[model samples]
Target: MATLAAECDRFKIDVIGISEVRWNGTGEFTNQKGGVLMYSGMPDEQDPHIRGVAVYVRKNVKHSILCWKAISERIIVVRFRAKKFNMSLVQCYAPTEDSPLDQKEVFYSALERTLSEIPRTDVIILMSDFNAEITQSIELGSLFPHKTCHKVTWKSPAGNFESQIDHICISKRWSKVLCDVRNKRSADIDSDHYLVVAELKFNIPKHRYEHPQHTRRTYNTTKLNVGAVKNEMIERINNVSLMEDASIEETWLHIKTNLEEICKDTLGYRKNEQKEWLSANSWELIAQRRSLSRQIKKAVKSDKRNYYVELSMKAQAASEKGDMKELFKLTKQLGGISFQSSAPIENENGQLVFAKNEQAEVWKRHFEKTLNIIHNESGELTIPRHLNPNRQIDTRAPSVNEIRGVIISMKSGKAP
Candidate 1:
């Protein structure tokens, strides 16, 4: 978790979808480095940790997490409340091609159900280690396979077989946000599967408040703690007129203008961070591979083609040799675990609400009626025989040890 968080920080990645985590049980935890890691796996203690899924979100993105559901060992989902719309990320590990047809069908059915739960307006990104080539089936459009030069994601130990099993799919509604998707073979993740990433362009909407839209302005309130800033703010506030006869609108306008001015002059504005994870060596190797691939695609002479293939095989072997402790830790954390549970709710009319929106409304109404209902029959109110309004409360300051002990009592790995 620490190594992955460091990599994400270096890459400036907001969120990463992961599969084949092989963990046992579902959990949300903050790693030692502060990034959020949420995972879902089998609940049974005896089951092997062969399949699991997770999402590692950077601190900035972690605050936006709305909810997460562990559907099964094969699937896990995390939903983020984005500015413009909700973003649903689904990570999956599907049955291998050699597995029974019924198992494959069951996995596909679960995946479909998961996808169906997401609202049409939300942005959906489906990432999976499918273990088989994908075909155009549902509205989720395949992105990486069609864009990369060497589309294969996995290579055999003998270097005799190459197949593309891992894939990324985006909702048809969000197809325009996709800039590109490619297989990063040079990524040294110490896995048989290469890293497949999709470049997306999303403009998060500004936060809206109850104030008049035209009169409102966003500010960096974080600077208020600086001594100089605080002094400046005090001076500015002191200089504002505050006559007793002043109209409410006039007073509000003055306050608003002062805040905007201070924010503009002192706190400044925020800038968007860019994401670019490739290291120098990785780029160089990728360029060489791409050129060789293009040359081969052009049907060059047999000798030249053979040379290109040999070089490509050597490069693939070198990539396979890279060691990543984090990858191994992920697998170990996933070893031997299984669990399962589900809940289905009914609507106000006693009919099941299959649609998400309807189900939400049904629950809202149920809670409102259940919690707010007033009883027609009344019961006698009893008061305590003895009461004291002037009871003294403890006012002594806490010692350093006492404060430390209180802090130590707080649970680690739990969300704030």
Candidate 2:
């Protein structure tokens, strides 16, 4: 029991949903430390041995128990938010005896009610030791092909069946199976049967919507704005620390991981003395820190003002010189802005919306605009001077001398 408590402490699990927490009137089990622990089947059942279900939620998560019920002698329903994704995680110990279909109906009904009671957005993770058979025909599809647990929960020394009954179910809205989320059967701890544990992965509510509509460094201009961006990246690096060293990639490759974390923060970073330990010299730590710092740099620059200011000079220069290449490059760089091919914004009104497309298309449109501007500004256009005079040159070409002048003019346009 002490070891279990220490494991829970080491993991920092937000909710420890335990089934069959056998309680005694005078044992140390009376003391529920670290979080709110709710144990059922106490005084009323005349069983001080609270045998059925229990849940311990960490204090900082800010959850009010939305609903709690003992739907079956072996099953319990709990609805709470592990940071806004309100989930209904049931603690079930399936009936040992071959109960009638009528009992199964009640268990299934409770599951249905539990799903309806919680927000659909919040996922349902049904975790239990279901001694009944886990057939493909069984209602739960989400927990299919129970990896490492393709065996029956009940073992009479003969080891008769190999179909998984102990399972965990996830609502379609809450999660999907990835290589990471897993559990395996283990020698039962403090019980006769083997134990099955699941590592469930849920989308943290604050992290789901990560992409910023606009990402300018500061709404206001000051060094503090820069710090705010830097701080946000710092927070991302902090989040990565929670993950095991093997699962994560090198710093640059995992920039998007920090993007979501960066978006969750009001300041975009966490502050601690550890951040101060980040060495400018070590590439490993530097890259890790820099990944987050890049997020801050972007947040600082992700505003309309900073965005426009950064592009203002380029936009004007592109407009003046009629160099489609540089103008297009500028447009490519400014990811979430609209621009026009002609000096008049109206010409490029619909043309200048932000969507992620290939680099070639960006350059293609940029040159098209540049060519158009060059055509309009110089009052001339250029093409291959073909003496063959093919019909492909559908329009008349300006005199070579005039076209040369236009080219020369644009080439010289970049000089201060």
Candidate 3:
């Protein structure tokens, strides 16, 4: 099973069906490389692994698996959700030609009923190692007409006979999805039957969270303490047109424009930070593991096989329980295990702003109003002792440190 999974990984197969996997009982287990393997065997504990069928789906695509069932020792059905439509994958191992007709009939009957049970609207892909030759006139007929250089699947042990017994059939509704199906004779898996690969063209849906896009701005607040930058910002703000009788909106716009221009010239902009959890060393180890796995499959001598096995184990161990750096990389590779919904925000009017643009605009108004407030209503007020008494509040120019501290105290990367 491990070797089979390694081959699947080597071939980059999204999903594969296995036949005659003489395992005892029906169950699912995770392979070393994280692929999902579901198999069905004899119902009784006393029975052996004969005629067992299984399906191995790659880790990346396993999340789309809706459900799976082990119908019998010879058949197992798995269903998956795709972008445009649902899909049902049926895998089976049919009785051999030498088997009794009644047994063959029972297998066919079960297979037919299984196919019938799947939703007619969903795309169906039926893959099986049917010991009966499809080339025989009484079988699937022209549905799988042979082409040159690929007339047979199973070769006799004596290298004398060959026949096309394995088959992959799709529902007529999804016939257009079939890109190509061919027998890969070069894949020598030590079995008389060659590997049959089928490629189907269908889009896989990418699930995403509907989160509001934030208009986060990054400012070089740390640069405000520089004497030259501080002086320049002050000079620019002092030159702004007050338009004494201008409406509140006009004055507000002028102040906003001047501040933005000065900040842009002095502070500059902040860049978006990219999250990198995976390290380079972890990726290299992964590549080495895959390479060693392929070599193990081809190694004939016991010593060479053992050498490859040890190397592969080292790679796997380095990936699993190695340094935090490598473990983080592996964790990043297995992404989206957790789901987090977007946080809600309150707008200027105390109403929630969930829409992307609306939220951004509301935040802008909020900061502008907050920063421009001259005095807080709850704070101590400077009032004249009498109606005629005059009062003046003394003010001093802010030092570079004070100016920089004010900017630093504000949200690090937030913009008004």
Q: lDDT value for candidate 3?
A: 0.77
Models 1 onward score TM values of 0.48, 0.38, 0.48
Clashing pairs in 3: 22-49, 23-49
lDDT leader: 3
Off by over 4 Å in 1: 134-150, 204-416
RMSD of 2: 31.8
Estimate, for each residue in 201-314, the C-alpha lDDT of model 2 and write its tens digit.
Answer: 653333233356553343222333587666755666676744346445555456665655455554433332224222456436534553665576578657756867879788
Per-residue CA lDDT of model 3 for 1-416, tens digit only, reads 55566567767778999899888798999865668999999998798548899999988788889999999999999999998799999999999868999989889999999999999888999999987654332333334455744646678897656777888889887898998777776554457787888878987654453454455577888888899888888888788878788999989998888888888888998765654444677557756765775676576457766765665555577676655555454455444245444555886567766667887887788777555434447875534334333556568888999988888888533583
Candidate that beats the other on TM-score, 2 or 3, i.e. the better one: 3
Q: What local lDDT score does residue 79 receive in model 1, on the 0 to 100 scale?
A: 88
Runs off by more than 4 Å, candidate 2: 10-13, 22-33, 42-51, 58-72, 82-84, 100-102, 134-163, 177-181, 184-188, 203-416
Each candidate's root-mean-square deviation in Å? Answer: 32.3, 31.8, 44.2
Each model's C-alpha lDDT?
Answer: 0.72, 0.54, 0.77
How well does model 1 score by local distance difference test? 0.72
Ranking by lDDT: 3, 1, 2
